[model samples]
Target: MSSSSEEDLLFAVALLANEEEEKRERKVWVHNIYEKRETYGEFHHLFPDLLKDRSKFFHYFRMSQEKFYELLNLVKPCVERENTTFRRAVPCEERLAVCLRFLATGNSFRTLAFSYRLGETSVRRIVYDVCDAVWTKLVPIFMPQPDKEIWERNELEFRERWNFPNCVGAMDGKHVVFDKPANSGSLFYNYKKSFSIVLLALVDANYKFVMVDVGALGKNSDGGIFSNSIFGRKLQQNKLDFPPDKILPGTNELMPHVIVADEAFPLQRNLMRPYPGDESKRNTEKRIYNYRHSRARNTCEDSFGILSKKFRIYQRKMQVSPEHMTKFVLATCVLHNFLREDHPNLLAELIEEATPALQDLRGTGGTYTGSALRIRDRFKDYFSSHAGSVEWQERMINVGRRNTNE
Candidate 1:
């Protein structure tokens, strides 16, 4: 109990505490294999070899090396980070490559972390940051707000390429499945019995996304989702800069520029759905209208098909949060549009020869306004008229009927 004995005891306790703290700090900042990424990572070792073989490079990144650099240059300002005294930041090119590979292969962060020689958490953060940058920088360039001229151009392409008049774009929704988040029960569950978020898109005739609304709950019907989306609200408010009504090709009757969709969407003055019921199928004029509608709407179907097949991320359930998944989906769409113009052959090969028609999610019970009904009628009449009819229309209709009967 002497003062000298107490001082010695206090010194001993302080020495033990310092040793324990040192152990904890060493565990927290331990050196690992990932620290040698500059020498061992795929980006450092394998990517240079890939550049020598263009085909392999394209397959690895889902884009040409040139395109990859171009994209990096575009998004560099947003994704680039400053280095600190502790460590240098991951290069912008490497960050973009990590994101593109994640989207191209849908690989998990653990798998990507090992391949890139980075921490799993670091991989996840890089994927999200690069995806956000891609969406922000590319969307305005690739999928800008459409004005009257853009809408008119799309209408002309639809008429020339798909044989549908007064149509600006084909509208549809795709369910991007993902793992259910904690505490989110049944909100993201769809009739397909999977958790998903809707990617509601309006695709142009050229298989490019004109506008997309991502991150709606899967349980909601496409109609409801579209009605609640920002794009849909702008459409409803007549603020989308759509061209005024114009006369149909070869007809004196004026019709509004309309978006063609399946029955999941309600019929509106600016939207058209096919004539329903067995009665319409029996009528030749109605049959022709449906045929043309399907032909034009097939663009949207093909866009989804190409996107899913090329990106491959939508093929599996994503593991990220819904917010991050939205960014991922939007980035993929921007890339789809960007690649569509320059790499048409590549995208063309991804299209399924016969993508089955999407089922009608909404039954035939909703009321249609008189104006909407009349707009559809005018289109039906136009398709059957001489000016709008293609030469092989009857033959195609007969073939479809025969196939159905058989």
Candidate 2:
């Protein structure tokens, strides 16, 4: 982030370099070539060597060779533009590669320009343009569209994989910090004591983001931000194609399909949060219910973790406009899903351990409907009974009690 921000001060200089730098200074290499180009040059030449050295490939590019090619092919059409009589355009492959490197490292345009043999101004333009293009072309194909069939499939998978029934997706919000924007005082300032925007994401059981809402200010509660988003409005108005209310696996009582979240979101017929207070600790059933709910909701947290640890940009504060940062969120999410589909081994390392930190469980949300409360109760009852209880959930809860000496 510091490297990138320092380069930001030189943006105007980059814009002026072609006219001033060479004019004032005698002779320097016109083409900014660096050592990375020797190895990073061409896929036809480099990819084979990269495949033979998978560890080096993952270290340098942070993706498999095939996955890189897939993304190159995906974004090429959108970012590629033909050159006319003016001159030959920069190759589509180079443009895509530069953007990927920037996203992968959050490196300065200065570093990218020299490393990729392009001018600084050109590198800056290419990277962000490809970012916008990636979001535009690939998002619809990769990010889950909130339709009934999709929702139902996601819910079924959550049940099959996590033993948590009636769950459509695991939803959560992550506050992405950024440097302050010009003339904006504290509108974007968050309780984290940073200027930021939040990315509200919903990932399915398999780690694909089924739904993502970006560009919310950092100051608002997750519930408030969610309630104000377009998806939230559609959700509240029943415009999204949520599955019809259905009976539990063994029970006669019908329950509406819902998204599971931490307590920072509202509990509704269509959204579920965990049981609250000392009762959840003292009561075995409620304790088991909280464990189930948290385990299911942890999918979203795991997805966020995978993204942060992989992308490494969200690991630091982004230095761009909130709107620009939204594009980053969108593109990374789409690419995250695309990579999840294309390369199962990409996130294999941390797949087993994706539990969120205890800090995530700290907040509370709004009062929901009586029906919502009853629906939660119904789930609680079902999970405690033989009809929905996991084979070892009671044992796990008991073990946890022993660990805490409760």
| TM-scores of all predicted structures | 0.92, 0.84
Total colliding residue pairs, candidate 1: 0
lDDT of each: 0.85, 0.77
**For residues 11-101, could you state the per-residue lDDT of candidate 2 as single tens digits?**
8678788678666553434443533354554543564576798666765566777777777787777888898653457778768777777
Clashing pairs in 1: none
> Candidate 2: misplaced stretches above 4 Å?
1-52, 84-87, 349-362
Q: Candidate 1: misplaced stretches above 4 Å?
A: 16-30, 348-365
Report how far residue 139 has shifted in candidate 1, in Å. Answer: 1.1
lDDT, candidate 2, equals 0.77
